[model samples]
Target: MQSQSVPRRWLSLLAVPLFLAACGTPESPPPEDAVVRVVTPYTVRSLDPIKQGLWSPEWGYGELLMRATDDGRVEPWLLESLEPESPTSWQLRLRPNIRFANGNPLTAAGLAAVVDRHLAENARVGESLPGADVQVLDDRTLRLTTARPVANLPHLLADEQGISVFDAAATEPSGDIYTGPFRVRSLSAEELVLERNPNYWGGEVRLDEARIRFVPDPQARVLAVRSGEADIALYPPTEALAQFTNGSGPSVAVAAQPLQHLRAIPNLRKAPMNDLAARQAFALGVDYRQLAEDVLGVPYRAPDGLFPDVVDYALPTQRTDAAEAARVLDAAGWAPGPDGIRQRDGVRLAVTVLTYGSQPDTRTVAVAIQSQLRPLGMEVTIASVDDNYAAMRDPAGWDVGLSFDGTLGYTYDPIGPLRSFLTSGAQRNFGGVADPELDTLVAEMEATPDEAARRPLLERAQQIIAANRYVVIVAQRSSPAIVAETFAGYLPSSVLHHISAQT
Candidate 1:
């Protein structure tokens, strides 16, 4: 499904959460037939998909459609098939013999109700395309009509957003609601325990019970993998690489996906970016190779353009020219001043860039960026806001910030992110870039059924966004998830952090 536009105000809501340190990381998959241990960096706060971002693991629980990797196809779980009856409308055929974990029969009307409920909840939270973009047709077969034609409907449907269809009554007076592969048995500040859905429609779930033991530190995560204390985990840093040992003690598996858009967030309302030349200077000054190699590590490769893996249009380009940056700075009327920093009309070319230090690497990369910009006589102050990544959408956040985003779908889908920028309330627009040409192309791409016609528009959008340096395309990262041996069935689909299973 296309991304629901996030309001600018929503940007303020994205920030590093204060880590609720679990007493200590728990041991790996329990000996019991059904128990599994999964490790992760951040703790999930909400079971509601609309309140949190759609693809979050909290949304990817006991249910949701898993994407097939071979050709990047969509397969079903709760659904049997979702065939389109019309360009604007489609019929979702639900598997007839299915039941919720609570033994409620899975019905189409119940699914429709969940959709409406999620829309209402998100709309209240300032989402622009909430209920405004969806319509449910009937009880057995819910018909959906979009504001525009979307080729990525299955991708949208496969998301964890409203995928979990709960029985209508369970959703009515609930403190908690669930309909995935696992049912939440209990949860607390320290742990979240889940039991396999006995009535799961997808046959037998691989394991019986799964518990997510929160480990806030990357080093601790690595230790768990080696000690066989955890089955799967995210946020393994370079320091923890030794533990992998080429799939050592507890063998490891890794997965990586590069995002289509990276945030080169310059406050359009602020100076510098407001001065087009200043924005260009910052864009050209960045060195992509160093950041990718030093910060991202050996397995990582820099992106060529905006989208990675896909040829023509990628982010980490084969270019890193300091001369180009200097030329742009000079063209913008920036001359060397007493401080050796560029000054145009008595304004020093210095600004603070905001990013969270949770992962730790972003800050190191930011330092490299600082040294590169310093020679160009620009002063950069990089601050760790922890939860501050979302603040860029707010004009008051910072002069600039780092933005990296990607969606797991058939291919690099630019329509959603592009539309996010054009739509009035989109939370993704930190740089505040708006172009009629881009808007037109994005609209056409969304409505058109032809891939041949759409490719050029997507290409053009990436080119211009990169050319304008809206968000400096630092690197389209190849996603890397270092996992433990005891863990298997980690498909990177099914699960947002990592599709996992107990070996």
Candidate 2:
């Protein structure tokens, strides 16, 4: 199941924007001093950094103590320095005179409060830093201690979706306060308007205003950029990317690596998937190479392992064999029926795939998998839902789920994805896979800080996942954003928090 090249029809879809550009009159561009509008599929559900996770910092409303670069380096952002005092304790020093957008000074006490709030409110953060204690030594310095040794403490703080520094004085969730380059002017469900923070500790802010519009539809987001209504569009349809590359429309800004990947998690608690042979058959049936090369086109790579090549501990590519998949099913007592669908006893070899429209690629890949698995006598039914995460919670409803997994992108470490998705009782382990060996390996990786020493542990963890087929990785894709020709300094990042617009 490999494609030599993308199909002719996909290449034909590139003509859509060209046709629109020739016939329809483009809208007038905004004034030079007007707000720079950005259209995206994501919506801000809450103003609170604790509730919104990395979105607040990504939107320029807040800042973190440390930041991870595009090339896997963790450096001080809001902090002056971070040094480990002992295996279980570390000291943090914040830069002088950093203040929130609302003029409140950011202090060690405020950071401690933010940590406390995150530990209490955000389960993900609490899980990463369990029994963590933060003590303010002074206005600018603090000590963080954990019950167990956390070698990757800096990595945890640098996590895009991890702890964010906010104004502790403000008791309520308001967008007005945060130590960032921009302050919230107005916020609504549809859009968020931000103004330059004149008192920002970091150098002068460039953009006067930035407006982020939450447009759920991918085509609508593309239209917003095509019509000159928006200066930037995030996560547009991949087929329409050719229109931007010719310099007639928006320029395509791609991340260094394809950190985000499409993964299918099989429900381990449900029928068919609970059987290891069935899970292996499901993994073997899908044509991942064809999906990446033909359907997704350029910038998308075939499924390799849980993490991409950029990650040092990533595993080698896994091959798929439809014949082997059929043999595995036959050995498992699943026989092909009159309709060509496999069955064991009275139950048919059927699975309902769960996906969401927010990420159009999920639905596209799901449909492609449905067609590919038909030859293996596996019945794959795709169910497009409004909420992908909520829908996947019920293991009884869906046997397989298709969604974009960015765990490594958010944390910049293999431990992040392994611990969050593959480990036993992980926060995002919707598949209900409880492997004790994997759990122990992830714990060892967490405790071992040295990247060189953690290699073997990481390798074994990936092997367990591949052998068990706990999650079927589909494809890895670059984070693409369409930027207007007028804008000059918008850098696309694997971690969304690193993205910023400069005039």
Candidate 3:
């Protein structure tokens, strides 16, 4: 579904001040009958699904067994149904007469072979679905057994690991294959071109050819769409939303599903921030609303808690109170020094916040946060790092880190991500949290299969996270795109399949 048209005030993030042409004038016509050209901020890391397809959506050459609808429902696309047969096993039934673009029939044996390939090489995928051994029952039926009883097995299978089912006999397991509406025509550093597959299982694709260009800079992407160099632009700069909404450019749209959140991760293992009181003060100090409305200049719903309300079992919203924040800092024995920064026993309340330059908004948020913490006597230094993850992993490299996290499992499930954050000893538990009670709750949530039973546990975990302030969630991200007026039949969902050609 298309998001509501952004108001004029909110479109300030997309405003381009120096451009003469707005939306009214059509730019140069399509190049020699070009179907559609898409410009995205993401660079093509790899065409192989196992390599980069799990995260990047650039390669849409293959299809998944099931896909999540815009409303986050898991519906069968390639597979008819995947039912649990035993505690550790599931029965998969393929849709009848499904065929790859190359005219290879999708059989149960071929899927089993693909599963084996993942198990042998892609350990991360294998770990995501532990002991995922597939057994073919017939041409249309297969049985899948996991090492452990993964409650969200179907969700786990919704990613690249479970989505693309290649026929082993027709092609090698690792090379590029076509199952979706489009087949890969050519791929280079600058662009990727696709040709419509006549034998695709999902019926005739609308577009004759789909071309995607990798333009990392947000401004360049917007300019491309505005100039008719591209039909659609992905991840436009939040500061340039005005350029799209002023009714002089391509139509701006936001896909709000599978929400991503930007958060502040305090190193719990450190000294000043190690104290719960300091952490609470840190959490309460930042004004998320100001950052959203003022700094971002875009329409953003300031997250009340960690996860947005759309996420299952998400807690109620919370806002910052400056008075309470000061009280909390005072209670923790921090006093305003001569420099107007907080100090206690010779130690200053100075912390460096590390973020990457790739996402321009992160730096803006960091600067805004640095300004917001001044009244609270917190000295925040904004550090724009080249490798954000490496800096986050290093104790000496950063004190507080800014990052956007994706949810666990394949779809919108939070259990996997929660486990990484809350569970003790989890590799991704970067905050150095060691709460036994929270760990127990995460374990319970992971073990429990029924969503009914899992709700309370998830609720309790959210409460614990709120109280501890492990990660200060700033805002939930709604990934936006601006498509040209000529780009018709655009697929509007979380799963962004290739666009169809305009009639």
- Per-residue lDDT tens digits for candidate 2, residues 1-503, read 01012112111222322121222333353455656888988887656566564776677767788887677677898899998887788899999989887788888777787777777677878877878888888889988888887877777888757887777677555556677888776666677777778778888676777878899888889888878999889887888887777756578888777778888889999898898988899888888889999887766888667777777777874678999999999999999999999999899999999989777788888889999999999999989998888888877789998888864755566777777787777778989989999999888877787779889998887788889899888888877888887764565776676334344
Candidate 1, residues 240-322, lDDT tens digits: the string is 56555664555444444444234456777777667777777777778877777776564455655556554343344336777
Query: Candidate 2, which ten residues in sequence have the lowest lDDT sum?
Result: 1-10
Q: Candidate 1 vs candidate 2: which has greater TM-score?
A: 2
lDDT of 3 at 496: 52
- Runs in model 1 deviating more than 4 A are 1-34, 44-61, 65-77, 83-87, 124-140, 146-152, 171-179, 250-252, 260-262, 310-318, 389-397, 407-412, 421-425, 478-482, 488-503
**Cα lDDT, all candidates:** 0.58, 0.78, 0.70
Number of the top lDDT candidate: 2
lDDT of 3 by residue, 1-503 (tens): 01112112211212422122232333443354557788876665445544544522224567677776567676676789988776677888989888776788877777776666656567766677775677778888888877877767666667654444554454222223546666665555666666667777766555677767889887899999888888888777787787767665477777656366787888988868887878888787888878777777554557778776666677863678888888998988989999899898999999888889877788988999888888889998888988777787777857888887754333667777887765788877887888999988876765677788888988888888888888888866666777788863353345454343221
User: Over the full model, what C-alpha lDDT does candidate 3 score relative to the true structure?
Assistant: 0.70
Model 3 regions lying over 4 Å from their true place? 1-34, 45-49, 52-59, 161-163, 173-176, 408-410, 488-503
Task: Return the TM-score for each candidate structure.
Answer: 0.78, 0.83, 0.87
